[model samples]
Target: MKKAVLILSIICMIFIFVQSWFLSLGGSYFDFATMFQGGIVGKILALLFIAGGIAIMFKPQVAMVVYFLGGAAGVLASMFIEYQDLFLWGIVALVLGLMSYLFNREEKEGKPGSNL
Candidate 1:
């Protein structure tokens, strides 16, 4: 579980960072146009998800909430964009959520006052 969580989290972070690079590269051949069409607010939200991914690497607790929100936002945003593999985004989100849940579950199990 830990290995899965680590690998997925790293991928999310890498994706986020790569997005910023894509932004600098004029976003040709990439699906940046649709996201930009979402306006400044949407861009900001997307950036938040990227930031959240980075934070997750350092702070799993906060990352869990961020991941949940990011996933929800992605699902909603997908309705407006024409991405090729949007379903994969949802699956990634599901994987992240499950990983975080499993990791937390084990942590709680070892603590005296845990709710698990």
Candidate 2:
């Protein structure tokens, strides 16, 4: 179950990058005002949430907080962005990160002489 969430979270991140890449290419670098004027905002928010999901690999406990905050931010961002998928992806990351954290805690508790 944890692995499933982790994989899904990765896919979300990949999709976000792909979408953002294409959106970014549509504009010129010289058009500074338009760089972050639209969909890019949601992409940035999604990236932050994905980053939190990745953190679960190194620090499950810390990632818990990040995921919570990221999820909230994504929900807030969804209010004004056309890419509502950001909210979906953020919720996914939050669930996955929490699942990973719980799994890690269970594993540690099940082990002998372990301190979590």
Candidate 3:
């Protein structure tokens, strides 16, 4: 479960970052802009998700909340933006966050001295 979350999180971060880069003024790929389309809002949210993804390696539960929130923000951001896999990745992020949350909870509870 952790591995799955880690891989997906990395993919999400990279996709967001790369897409953002390709859309920036310095970039020239007009076709790529439609892939994610969130403007500055998307970029900021992407940074948040990136930070959450990195933090998850050390702290699963807390980072997962951040991850989930980032996903939700993406979904909300979609109201104004367009495309971006038709918001498919946002839902994926939500599911990934939920899975990690539940998995970490179970792992913590199953431990010898866990109180959960």
Residue 24, candidate 3: alpha-carbon lDDT:
56
* Stretches of model 2 off by over 4 angstroms after superposition: 1-3, 23-38, 113-116
Better candidate number, 2 or 3, judged by TM-score: 3
Q: Report the lDDT tens digits of candidate 2 across residue range 1-116.
A: 44565566667778877766655555436454343343576567557656666766677676677667767766676676555666776676567667767867886898998963
Q: Per-model C-alpha lDDT, please?
A: 0.56, 0.65, 0.67
Per-residue alpha-carbon lDDT of model 3 for 1-116, expressed as tens digits?
66667777778877876666555533334544533355554576667666666666777887778778877877877775653541565676687778768878888888998893
- Evaluate model 3: give its lDDT: 0.67
Q: How close is candidate 1 to the true structure, as a TM-score?
A: 0.59
Residue 26: error of model 1 in Å?
A: 6.3
Give the least accurate 10-residue stretch of model 3, judged by summed lDDT. 25-34
* Residue pairs in candidate 2 whose N, alpha carbon or C atoms collide under 3 angstroms: none
Ten contiguous residues with the weakest lDDT in model 1 = 36-45
Instruction: Rank all candidate structures by their lDDT, best first, as comma-separated numbers.
Output: 3, 2, 1
RMSD of each: 4.6, 4.0, 3.8
Question: For candidate 1, lDDT tens digit of each residue in 1-51?
Answer: 545566665676556445534543444445477644433323444455555
Q: List the residue pairs that clash in candidate 1.
A: none
Counting clashing residue pairs in each candidate, in order, gives: 0, 0, 0
**What TM-score would each prediction reach against the true structure?**
0.59, 0.66, 0.73
